[model samples]
Target: MSKQPPLDKFERDVLDESVPIQQLLRLVIVLGGRAFSEPLRLWARNELQGYPGPGIPLPTYRMITAPLQMDSHSRFSQGRNETISALALPDVAHDLVSEQLPVTFSVGKLQNLISHQDPHTPLKLGLPGSAELARLMTSERSGQGVVVERIYWSVHASALHDILEQVRNRLLEFVAELRATMEPGESEPTVGQVHQAAQTINITVGDHSPVHVIAPHRHSATVSFPTRPHHRWWPRR
Candidate 1:
């Protein structure tokens, strides 16, 4: 029988606590310059065990349940504009900071890329090839650059503050290591735009009754539950 990969401290804690799925949040990490989709996907899969969605849940909770998706304009061609998203529950976000999983998992994965000097390494996860394209995008010598456009998290109001703190602290370490790996004399890459916004839904009454949509801005239409029933339906991200 194949041996299972060892779980990190955070992973152990997650399993120990049996963290419930409170809120599902979508985190989009946009790369400004060309990011080879295949290699990036491979890297995520091999190192993080984050594969294309719909994915089975893992202990890490930092699963990339979606594939590397590019903007509509760059769908057919290799373009600098691209996006990769992953899903994390509130409990998972908490562990990333509390258990220092970002340093061991996130930074460790990045360290693998910097240590391998060859850009043409075979495409293998946890191996050199899978990270080749990702390495190039971040390398100053390659001329092709990669910058984060933004990191947006669609979350509920209650879990916003806690999740934001975890993400911010973890991202600081992640970005720092990425910059440290750049070629000599290369300008350090800037941290990508980070936006945390509450998700909103428009609820319309089926009885032709006036509805009050409360939010900074409103768009999209959804069926509103009747107030008489006091039905509680929380939207998922």
Candidate 2:
């Protein structure tokens, strides 16, 4: 068997849970820049600094789906704000409910949120077009005096932790590939070697190719809730 290269130490570091993910990401950015791999560098940069804006493709792992909730008041539940499903809005307003919420936060931001959050309380993110949805839903039942206060997604902390774990796993995979590509006694990988290894990995390259994920078959729990009557027509926003 050939002696492991010094760069192999990175594999051990990647496997260490105590090592901050941001630290590994910074190292990746440095390695990517040294290797002249734009894709690798860009990916690491985005993870550290966050994606520029909307319309940019995000990694499949960064997309998470959470239950939508809304705080509102109706004649039936007068005076008190009732928390109900944002999905309970009229069928016309259903288009506003995003099934998959893209997590564009930087790795460091996510880490900070997870660290300070209480395990029992979920982090709430304001849903886009929430105001519009509230207006539409309120107008649809104007006679009923329904007032929509807030619309947001209740995201579990574990989900954010999962994203960090996935990032670590990807780094581990890349380092392993780098190790395999290194020649005996070589301390570091060449630019060609780095590029070749990156091409084999799905997310390392900037290509927006679809990542096929096989979801485990798990039985979903049935949730019963009171919902408003469906409207045949959608009110124009």
- lDDT (10s digit) by residue, model 2, range 4-67: 5446557777888998888888877777666655677778788888876655678888888887
Deviation (Å) of 54 in candidate 1? 7.5
- How does each model score on TM-score? 0.20, 0.76
lDDT of each: 0.26, 0.69
Best model per TM-score: 2
The TM-score obtained by model 2 is 0.76
TM-score between candidate 1 and the true structure? 0.20
Q: Candidate 2, which segments miss by more than 4 Å at Cα?
A: 1-6, 75-96, 204-237
